[model samples]
Target: MNIKLKTIFTLLLVAVLGTTFCFGQRSNIYIADKPFVQEYSIKYNFTNERVTLNSVVSDRNGYIQVLSSHGLLRPKAGQFLFPGELVNDVQYRPTSDKGITDADIYKNQIIYIDDKAVLSNAWAGNLYSRHDLPNAKLFSAGQDFTFLIADEMELNLLKDSETLWEGSLNNEIQDIKYDSENDHFFILSAGEIYSFSPKNNKLELVLQNDKLTCIEVAGKKVLAGTSDGFFEFDAKSKKHISQIEKNLPWPEITTIKSVDGETWFGSTQGAFKLEKNDKFSYYASKRWLPSDNVIDISKGPENSVLILTDAGLAKICRKEMTLFDKAMFFEKQVRERHIRNGFNATVSGMTEGDVTSGSMETSDNDGLWTSMYLAGEVFRYVVTKSEDALQNIRESLDAMERLYTINEIPGFPSRSFERRGYKYHDKKWRRTEDPEWDWKSTTSSDEAIGHIFAFSAIAELVDDAQLKSKAILLIDTLMATTIKNDHYLVDWNGEPTTWGRWNPEYVNARPIMVGDRKINSSNYIGMLQTAYHFTGKEKYKKTAFGLMEKHGYLENLMRPMSEIGRAPETADDWSRMLSESWNHSDDEMYYCGYWGLYRYAFNDELKAKYKEAIVDHWEAERPEKEGLWNIMTAIVGDNDYDLEEAIWYLQEYPLDLVNWTVKNSHRKDIELIPENFREQTIKEVLPPDELRISRHNANRFDLDGGSDGRSEYSAGDIWLLPYWIGRYLGVIGEPVQK
Candidate 1:
């Protein structure tokens, strides 16, 4: 065959194999269609300062009732009733009765006790049973109208408004719970746990501990809470079932309850639920509660959990959702509040974390963030062919195009742009030739690589001829200018920006251990390969090869990840600083550049090497469970790149994007480790909701951070990009039917 015909035939063969690989085995490759818990919270603050909440219960209708020192109070909903919706109008309205001290839900009936008598709200408000109880503190109801009431030092058993048996204890009573399966009531005090059998009229000590504070009985186990932690005992054997569990979010356990066969604990610091695999889903801070000091917990309306705190009540609701469902919800979130002049932006300066009180703000890395969002939309358009996705791509592409034209330099893209006087206070802001506009300077390599990644995706995947041409032109403009200026992005001041220099002199100066050495080589070569692939330009191809063979760029890019660490003591100051810790931003830059590096390799041999490098880096990053990085690694057709963890990341991320203050450094459940070069603080990473709101550039292992709800991050770059990209790669399936 002629050389021309041979080349065409090879291209056709590659196309056929690519199609087979992408769609043929898609059934086995996609994310499983399983439901995940999506949690959100609704909080109601105290109406008055005098009401002291003692206990909480919910009836069959899911109406929440709180027993306080003043009276029975019902928390009325406000105009807005959805989860994560904030309204100040929800108030605890008092009932006609007063001086109620204890309450319980007995067979869907709300029963109450006061200083004088026991009352049942089950019989048309006329079921008052008189009793000689004084200073009633707590009560447990049993079958056939049997009640076990306790005071500070005494207990009274009443049946049919008559005294059945009375007993005394050595210490102050704390709580009481009835075990229906065992036909007995378990009593908790400061020193001991006792079981009272009404049938035999006997009270016997079951367990003895001075620190016991609360008690709960579930089927065959009895759980007792204490100041240090909690202990479990077998109900049938009356012996210890487990040791004291000190590994908790907070150990000062104040209350414990079993709701829907799942255990929930309330501590002085917050509340947490015991999930499968011995993990606790921590609910603390203002994001999930009104205050961290939890008083009680109960099942609430619509399969929610109600947490009573010193300041107010919090209702945590969970909805069943798949990854695709979450993606669509985040898509709406971005379009509503995060779009600023077609650039994905954050809402900053929010007053006390109120979403309605914030305004969109420009950022230094707007170009990078917008490029990520644009690439996500292009992937969405490719996967689903949604018209809305195409429109989003068009709008954001316009914003990206303006980044080049807004500045005076021919191929330099601005960091961001704003009105002339609005951003003039910053030293990086410069007046454009246009009178009404100003453009940000000092653009970093992060923005440069992000632009190339988005442009390459558009040039290869988008079907629009005009859009594809524009994307290729931008790539040529950027790469040509870099080559013309000795591989440096020249600013209007005729100096190279600090981070945009990838010339051999600067890149090769860093020690091999420093991440910047590897990342810069990888990014620069990827850009050259992408340019040559799209534009068919020999200059880009030649420049890329010359750097690889002569300057050892290929060796630098192919260095194993395990060998990259802190610089030697004899290294330069800049190299030492760059290697002092793992630079998470470098991770972001590397993955963003991976799209071009792996997809547009110069030849099959280079493509195989790129896949090895990408997979090696992913192996080191497995501890983080970062969805974006894991999903991006799937582009190399590896089936074992922690796909389950990727899905877990998407599912576990909180629906509320508000930057509420979150702290996990004080948690007792997590296993802390010695400080290392990777900066991993614990043996395992906390879920996304338990950590602060952050973008892909932030370290996931950072224990505590936030602005106390002063800003809301955009979901466009944080969530939607990874999700849509996963969908486009056939690693995540469509939304499953309910």
Candidate 2:
């Protein structure tokens, strides 16, 4: 049950994140496959792959020049360079200096040197030195003259041999920039902003603060990058007005730049953009960048932003598109990247895999994972009427239905299936005595939940009579077998499976405090209702109502979530279940069973009670910010759901399907909730990959990690279920076409 339920939510999440409704404009945040690194020996090549990125600027000819410690490297004979094509190999004479101190693109040429200003055309292999300012530390190009800050505590503005303006601030300057509006050369010295106006040949202190680390000018405002984020100061008033760090996702702001009027923030973690509407968007982590550390940023062609990081350089551009376009892209990638085939087994998609190897070991819950895939296709067919979706539904349903007939048992579903000679360590595969195939037994309640959930979706959504009949037969057979065994799934060994018990004696035996009491109660009636609905069998309906009236299953299932955890004393029959922490498994069972409980209710009165119970369960789950639970509650329709929050979950979901090791245990950014039964913590949910492969019921705050930083499992059912449910419920409409 643990493996199956875990895989359902896990697989659904890792592989497929479709188009998200606009947070206004539909934009894609992506990491380039090719990073502008010295390793690539392209525009920013150094001696090796690793090098410090000092600066990046675009020249008048639209050529991008990147300055690094090794040198100012560009394409050999043209503007474009491929990875591994080194500077020397591309050009006979690299033209760039052996070592670069500082550089800027000035008037269609690279103006750079350690101690002199060399105006060089990289592609044309032309170089000219116009100034020899000894001990020159840094320089920025102005309209006619060049501004240089020397290590000898001197600031000089010169054109040719003529000195336009000269002054000494008496403080060591770290960086220098030209503000065209005021004609002031802003000097970052001693963590202060000092301006030298060549027009007036005078130096004046503009702003001083211990934390002023960097500076840039946009429009009439002087932007100061500091510990508190970027400070916006009016150039005319010279008074700080506002700080733009309110929406910064990462701290340790490193550099700030205005890209065509948009505020771009570079930090030790990643880069962020503060849009005009005061909202923030994040472009961070290895998935979105070569490295989290962003050192510098510059304007690129067509409003794009160029970013320089410790590992490489990248460009981010926004285009006008729709969510549906992205959804099609996602679908294509998942089909190409995630699909895997096992020896003699049906073709199926992996929940997650190694990004490099592109292979994933089979999981124990293949049945459940395949069921989710089937259900997703079912929903897709319902919406788009796509024949391909119908075909995918058929294939996935075949894989799921095989779980029943693969073994000798008439109605029992196998946990998974494999080839005859397949080798494994956890459990020996039974031969089924069928020479061609092998199957796993001891199916749990989670398998049943997945089977019934998927079959119900297919039977309800698909129009094919044969498929509907097949689903109904399998559901009825499974339900009748459970009933025949006193509401327990007695395995081939004639013993009840660990989680498939719903007998009144077992369901009613546990005290109200035990999680299984609520779990078994809800599933018992839910399963009975499902069987009755599809089969229209009086026996199934009679048994469902009888369980409610006789065993108080409705009351048991409806216990307030607050009172559902461990009580003052423990029972011998429920010793392991006795814990202060709320049981996540119980939550999974109740919610998974909610569909059967409400959708196929015996009557209207019982349906109302089920809705009330669902509302209470959703309220208890609100703090988790779980997209699945929230979307499931929307299906119940008892309360106004958080539609926006649900959309945020889908939108913020990372595109990279690989489960990279993400460590947030020691992060101070995550808010910690006071310790409670369910172990709730974190005011905001972390990225999906950062989270453990847990069922929907697990406490969002349960802090557990594995030694291996790789993700081998995913809760795909978690995503597909809610997305399909939303589509079916009309909460999410057809995406806008291009």
Candidate 3:
């Protein structure tokens, strides 16, 4: 359900009413009492010294039976889907001060040697052995059958003390596991595997390999762990099949387990999964494991994989959908809820009356926000050719074109629009002073850059003649106004807007080290190229070349970043402005402007220079893991660009879009750096939507604990843009549009 908080009821009821809101019909101004809050079904259970998983078994009914020192935990069917539900735990503390001595289960029965001789089964049997078996280290049970490996390498198969078969491998054994499929006990010694069958009272050699560590049976294949690699054999014919040693991240495999045809190998370094097709996937990041030294691997509920490390246990559930599924879902969400006619809704982050479920109402940067959405749809239509995508682009382009006309000025675009009765707490939304319509004035250069970026994409991609002409006209008007008004974005007040300073005098006045110098050069050149390419206006092309050759705009933009920021000695008015603080917003402008920079460059020489500049900017930005930057970099033909990191950014992004209160300042896991600008700490990306509401320009590492914990941010714009862009670039494949 889509929640749009059009009005605020009260602050006291925010936590009580939850993040979801019920709203009336669409209105010009929708006031929110708080931000939306999203609840996550995912959870993490951190195990400590008192709680540790030892062994795990999956029943036919899909219940995961966990054996631990604290007790045996049996999760009810479907427990993984529901949070806060308790699993059925049978209490039995292990007697060993260090760990469980022996434990195993088979055929709906179990037996173990903890402190005392203990046994359990469906028949309600209370059995205990009087003899002291202090050296017993392994146990297994099957339908009225039990086995124990004790003292030296003695193996005893017993039925009520009958001792059906007793023998010793005569060498110290490493580990043992019961292969229920063959109803036999597979034992591992220093360098070989032996299978003992109770049905025939016979011990047979399965296979021989050096430095054997562990073993597992998977259908027709027998997997053995060696000191340096993995060995596979044909289980039916006992024939050697293959050996794998090179690709393993860690060779000394301690345990091997299989689930749904995927085998998991646990080693001291971490765990690796061998898929059915024989491809390997590694899991070594601290985000996934409490400790990399894994001791055991077990089948978990809901097809999840349970890993017991030396420090704690982790349950990895494959719950996230494919990137394609999420991208399509976000596209639909943006289309239905985010797009207010053509203006993308943006809420004021500082407002207190925002609703928890809906988008924030704002009269700022609507053109910029909508332009990004428009570009996403343009890419979407290019790939999928869906009518919906085309229609969306048309609507957004119309809205953007309206920005130019809604105001009295011929080429000036309004920041945003609203109905008369609506006003924000900060008074940022002003009346066009028109009777029925209210539009914001004093739009910034960001809006203009966004308008040009989207307009260029539409003009180049959309097949509709009418839409293409309108896009070109808008570009011509915007560019002509800038060129005619002394290369400045004149505002309603007749003074240039604070951010609209592109005049060569103003841009060239700044020291080359200032970010404004390079940003203005890059943005102006990109804009002029876009206007000239779309409208075939010679003046646009001439002015662009004039700035490049006469003003050294090209060289200014190509300045080495090392000289960019050397902290201002004193906070001048310009230095104190938020835009001057590394001005991530400018980064957003530069990358978005790249479409025009390279794609519509004046010539091949200039195009190559633009690519070089973009690469330099991207090289500095790679550490941040900002998805849009990586995707856009790849789009510019950097095939060797970290495409995997692009996928990681998409996958690791949080599911919750709410700017929740997340605190990492005191966490032990984060490696805090000694810096001044932001809270730069190295840590795993928090679960989706768990972090603060971050703009594309914000640093990925900055920790944020939201103000009121109510705002639900719109992640659709950020995610959909790159996802569709990836699809268009062939880095990501397409999905069936539903």
Candidate 4:
């Protein structure tokens, strides 16, 4: 063959092999082809002190009108336009010439009821056309200016200025809704559902249940909201279609309505949308509503849902976004407010969730957090070849490098560093030789393992020689120091930090059931393997084997996850305390170290063993559906590692990372289990948006916690790390095109 043709043929053959390999490795997990809907709130709080809102409606012109006890009120836009920003400037200005009691949207126009008449803006210009009906309590408007007006005892149907029919019922009327498809009105009294045919001018009883509160009609279906739950009925048959839907975020149904072919329910506790899968997307608390007491629901502008509560109005907006799109948003969020001296940090002490009023705070896990962020950027750079990711890597790597140099201890990384005299009341902060700075001491094992995880990733994945060498040197320094000092992180004071001990004396001292024994063993061996892999140091390998064979470190790490539980009562106070419940932080440390332990094993036999241990750990962690842990387990080439659950975690995570006060302990739907060793609070975990904004180190089953919007967490380690790593591992695919 000619040289050009031979070269092309070789390239084609390589490409075909690569494609086959990729398909073979592709997980059996079904990833959604379309983008998921990300929901957020745009709140319009109650600002008018003189008026109390009763009912709300939205017109096709995108105008929202509320019926207050005094008059009709319309919303005025707020100054701030950002998503998730609280719009307190929305004033409900009076738009009616007379006082109004109730209202509904009829043919894209507002039709309302007053003490003396039923009025509408659908007739002409700005003037409302009225049909006299005294003591109107409730009303609904149908096609061609037809109206169904109801009082306590009387029901009146009117077409324009002329009355079509009048009827009386035994029970007091509660609500009225016009069904365009059936050409009739579904009426709800205190206990009965009646279908009134306007064409025949007759009212016939459909069903009777004492618990019924309100009614709605969606095409051929009739929905009745009861005191306990809601019921669905076939409109044509006028019979119940199925059992009452009691499985909801909250029962005690208050109202029901259909918007854009979807049924929405308003309850005493919250508002929720009935999804296509027969599940509910719940909206409650301050995150999605002003109050839990939802008085009404309607369709709003731009594919949003307007929920009226006692405190104000909440516009739940839906936007179509892929997981990659969400990652980009969180990327901006981190760089804008979370980067503190090149280390990913938190914004704290905010005034009522305002991001601007917060200050970046130092943390004990600064090294671990910065390392996770750096590793994420490494994955991002490798996958996308993004210059921004490369720049981020360089900046964060500089911060990680300084952690060792900032302190006199050879490889003991400082917890954090800051300007001298800036930190207060913390004795852990010590003055460095440089008069301008202070470095924190008492660094823990988590920081040590996290540093190895990131440094080894850079040393192995990054092509830049200088960056690779720097990473390897850090690994060597840390592992050398640990081995030299007898498996402990010795501080400048010549004493091992409290939680940094990995000697057999400490590891074997704890009961076998304690998680510390396994976690510490796992981390130390991983660090040794990583050190040997990157620096080609034989001592690292020799020491790792010694610990594994002589010290029983391998047995400890390879112990079944089911065996971990509360330490024996005879054990030390520390061991007992550590095993009181599952340590989610240990889960984080184990997954982070697994990158090094499994990838840089001494041989294939140990690699297989490490994969077994790693998968066992992942099995224990499956209930949390943690994205990072599951995606990290993909390194072992498992066919199924809960990839869908991991995707759920990534997608369900809220875009607003502010530490809002989220409460779920009071919820009635979730089944609470008795407190156990794993600390699984409920039978099922709530979506991330319903829980507090927490890192992977926090328990996903934690039912309730927050700083009441007093802080915001960085998304770098919590979200972006998993997503970028997932993309790099090819467990998660690229963004789907529109």
TM-scores for every predicted model: 0.93, 0.81, 0.62, 0.91
Q: Find the 10 residues in a row with the least total lDDT in model 3.
A: 30-39
lDDT score of residue 36 within candidate 1: 77
Candidates arranged by lDDT, highest first: 1, 4, 3, 2
lDDT of 2 by residue, 435-545 (tens): 877787677787787778777776665766666766766778789888888888887778888777888887777777776778778887888888877766789988887
Q: After aligning candidate 4 to the native by TM-score, how far in Å is the CA of 682 from where it should be?
A: 2.4
* Separate clash counts for every candidate: 0, 14, 19, 0
Best by TM-score: 1
Off by over 4 Å in 1: 1-28, 47-50, 76-94
- Please give the range of 10 consecutive residues that has the lowest summed lDDT in model 4: 79-88
lDDT of 1 by residue, 531-560 (tens): 887777799999999999999899999999
lDDT to native, each model: 0.84, 0.63, 0.66, 0.82
TM-score-wise, the better of 2 and 3 is: 2
> What is the TM-score ranking, best to worst?
1, 4, 2, 3
10 residues in a row with least lDDT, candidate 1:
79-88
Tell me how far candidate 2 lies from the true structure as C-alpha RMSD in angstroms.
Answer: 8.4
Backbone clashes in candidate 4 total 0
Predicted structure with the largest lDDT when compared to the true one: 1
